[model samples]
Target: MSQATCPQCHAPFTPGQRFCPNCGKQISSTGEGVIPTVAASNSSLPPTMAANSNEGLPPTMAAGSNPNLPPVGNSNPNLPPTMAAEDPANHQQPYSQYASGAYTPPPPPSYNGYPGGTPTPNDPYAPPPPPGPGMYSMPPIPPKKKNSLPWIIGAVVVVLVLAVCGGSLYGITQLFSKKSTDNKTQTTTDNNNNGDNSNDTATKSVTLTNLAISYATDQITFTSIEQADQFPDDTYTKTYSYEKKSNFVRIHMKEKQEGGRSAYFSYSSAFSLILPDKTTIKALNAGEFSGPKEGEQRENWVDFETKKPVDLNSLVLRLGTAEEAQMEFPLKSNADLSEYLPKQADLNKAFNYGPMKWTLNTAIQRYDAPGAQAKKGKVFVIVSLTASNPSSSDFWGYDYIRLKSGDTTAAPEYTSDDDDLNDLSAGASNVKGTLIFQVPPSDTYTLVFASGKNLSGTNVTFSIK
Candidate 1:
């Protein structure tokens, strides 16, 4: 048979159903009703459907609303008593059974009313029963699992960064430390070598304090020493300025010396040092000293230096000219400088030269030269010379004659014809000429003939003091 639909809700249901399960509306078997009658879900059962009640209608006829079906009351002997359990009351009472604490599972649905199907034993599609009243409590919701992966990775990165930085810093520190240690070691070694060198110089050097030595015409007493920086010292002083540091000592007694051969001793080459190798160096920075007068003491400081280091202990004082230094008592330093001066011919004598024989007849000082006047602190010296050329080559007398002192030299005055000694003819035999020289008034001088026409190095010396 085709399934019938509920009238009020128009929902498809079984023909034997007395109410719609979806909308719970009562069904009429005779015809579809336009009016809807909804049963209250929690209301008490009607009197006609109550158990053991003598009502107007029987169970099967009222429960199913099927007019063609016979009534099956409790009085029917041919039907089972549970046959009336299909009533709507019995159909909706399963939930109430749970509420009353007596729930029981319902039987599987019958499929005999379905098309082409017999009743199956187990209906897999049946609705499950509610659990017993006290049997259910929802399983506790598990706490949410937390994730720590990002935190772990960040911590690892931080640790790696710190490790790299620490390693780099340690390496840099070690490098600097090693370099500093090496520098310190080198400095210490150099200092030790310097100390050894100082010891050696000390062994060779002699003490200078209060050491007195005798000379030819004077005596030298050394009182103190300040080593050199070796430039010329224009002013004389007992002490000096230096560049480096040393063990400096002071002198209570001033350094004293006496030399009278050259009255201007401090400005001349009077005091000198004789080295062990027989080499000599003159002192430049000495105290102001002068005088050939008797019993006169002069202050002096001997400053001497060399291009190379030497033994100071073997050094000797040479108080006069270097050619006349004395080592023992009668040493060469005892000779008068004038006696040891270079050999010179007498003014009245005739000397033979390279290509000529010349006689220096006489000399006289005047206030005026041939063509030029004498300077304020100067005088004019006029001398007559007789010359003869014994050689074939011509010679010039003016080119060969000159006056010389330590560093002062004067040429023949060339302002007039009388002063021109160049007029002496070549190869002449007896030529006489007058030459004039402007020189300082009060100094010792030498007359020199340095060269001739046919030769060189004539270099004859004559005293003109």
Candidate 2:
């Protein structure tokens, strides 16, 4: 029997043993008489085994052949041809032939110590065992997606922007609505105020009893009022030419000073007459005069002329300032004119009016002058008067004196070469002057002297027969 090494455990074994007692690998006698030659360069076999068989060895233990071992004779003629031996001194096995055998591994035997069958070299056809726990790890769980904080932040920003824009639009709308409402309210209020003012202006009335009379800074009291009317007469037609005929109303008022100051009144543009129909007539002419010194009273007159006859009962007189505190006098025109006309007086007797006295010296009618002819259908009436001012104060001659004949009245004509009776000083006596008047020839006439320019005051009439 030959002693051989167990290729699996490298332990000594008898040649006839079929399996190694140490590693439990199979041992074969078919290797007998086969040279333990190195495998060919292209063959996958162990170097320690012959090329035809690796019967006693495991695949991992096969390396180089040991030439010191004695060669055994061949006992099987059917074996494949062996590699020729080389000289022992220089012999080398190729590194590629080491552990390069094509041997099939056997199935592993059961083992009580391990959980499953142990793998062997000859078990190439066996399926791999299932992997034990913890041997493989699941693919690293993809890290959970981090919370989408950026997306959340972007959404919040968009929402805030929309909210801000919407709020601004809403605020603007409210502001405009409020402004429009305010404007409408103001307009309504203004209209109401205007309506009220109009109502107030339309209903107010002023009257003579309640006439506002003021002098300087003090209010004055009205003492008496006198008025008269003058119609066109034959003398007026013969002496004066007019495109439009008119009637004259003379208004006179005596105002007493209530305060301790002399009051002066001016009649320029300060008079207007409101007719029954509410038509207003401005003064045709005005005159100015001063009232008596404090507590004394004097009369002044204002004249107005109109083409249409006025209803004196409904007439309203406005005097003084054109603005505030205008004096209003409502008059009655039913007074008899004969009561105010003077009675006929002799030419030699003196006639007295206020502080002045007058005497009619002569009356004559002439149709021609020294160098000028009298106007056709007209005659000149020349009257000589002697006036005396007995009062201490100067007397202003009445410029409104006239001559009346039937329905005619004639104003004095100053065109004659006669001295005018204007200002007369105190204590003056026998101031003689001639007053000339043009009139139509008449059978009867009266020489009249008025106190003031409107012919409203005392009148002295001298009958010329």
Candidate 3:
């Protein structure tokens, strides 16, 4: 709104005027150039500002404003005046675009460091330049994820090893301890019995017979002697029943028999038993069985005069009807009597020792229908040993018993005879005196036992556990 004098040409012009009309020089705030200076006045000027102040000049003369003008006193006044150069408004300042460029941007105002172009000189809330990228570098990468699997595996392995070792040690300790304890118990038992003459209740005697009847052992008793001198070779009798249905024998003791107390008794005796088929079985050695001889019958006679190993394969004891049972136990009496007499060899074959003790072992063999070929669920009668003889006497003597109906010859595996009544045997006996049999599932059985001339009857009973 005002004009000032140009220092070079003494000419006045407005503030935006870049060159003086009379001379050539740049205008400055100091008014030291030929450019026109603005003058303050009350004069009303148009509010529109033209980008080129040269709009006031003719286009031809506008180009001539760039001037390193000669002095205003030059004689040639016909030439258009050259003015001083001025800054162009539309030109871009390259350095101003980037903060790092050569040009420095004006500092933000003092308050909060926000751009106000110029600072409030006394503002108290101004801040420094905002934090730079340098302050925000990423924190270093976190440590790799910690893996605990290896530690867990190691701990488990250690625990397993410890457990295995502990188990092995414990097993070894127990093994040794058990062996020592067994030896100690045996020693103590022997020491206590050193001079004792009383018979051991555990050591009992049992008589054996061949009866084809299924019978269950309810109670059994055996009598044992401390020495052979106490063994009695006396004649005795017992009753038993041969089951008609199961073809098994059930044995019972005679009330008059001294050893007949309940179903158990004690005795020490050995004898050779022979069947009707001439199957000579040694009932002496406690562990020997005799195989069926030629033409052997099922359950006929138990000769106490023959001692031979009995092979179970040679024997036949089958479940059959009462009518069929007779086929197995045919009644055959020797009219000549001398024809069936036992020989000296038979007497020698009698039980090797006497006054021996034995324990009975009874168990269920089979329980099925009645018939030589019956299905399951049918029952068989169980037969028990009623009496037996231990004397090695007359050669002509033989044992006789009645298996009136159901009867089965004892397998060699289930026969035994002990040598010393009060002492242990040399080996374990597979020959068990006690027998187990299954009768009709819901029925009972009966049998009988007797003595031969070569052996005296010693009544005794047996039972199941």
Give the best candidate by lDDT: 2
**Each model's lDDT:** 0.47, 0.51, 0.30
Report the C-alpha lDDT of model 3 over 230-321, residue by residue, as the tens digit: 11221211111121111111111111211111211111121222343656333222111221222222221121221222221123222123
Model 3: weakest 10-residue lDDT segment is 222-231
Of the two candidates 1 and 3, the one with more favorable lDDT, higher being better, is 1
> What TM-score do all the candidates reach, one by one?
0.23, 0.24, 0.23
Which wins on TM-score, candidate 1 or candidate 3? 1
Error of 2 at 111 (Å): 99
Candidate 2, superposed: residue stretches over 4 Å from native = 1-346, 417-420, 453-465
What is the model-wide C-alpha lDDT for candidate 1?
A: 0.47
User: Which residue pairs in candidate 1 have backbone atoms (N, alpha carbon, C) closer than 3 angstroms, thus clashing?
Assistant: 216-334, 287-301, 324-332, 324-333, 325-333
Better structure of 1 and 2 per lDDT: 2
* lDDT of candidate model 3 versus the reference: 0.30
Candidate No. with top TM-score: 2
Cα TM-score of candidate 3: 0.23
lDDT of 1 at 298: 64
Using TM-score as the measure, what is the rank order of every candidate, best first? 2, 1, 3
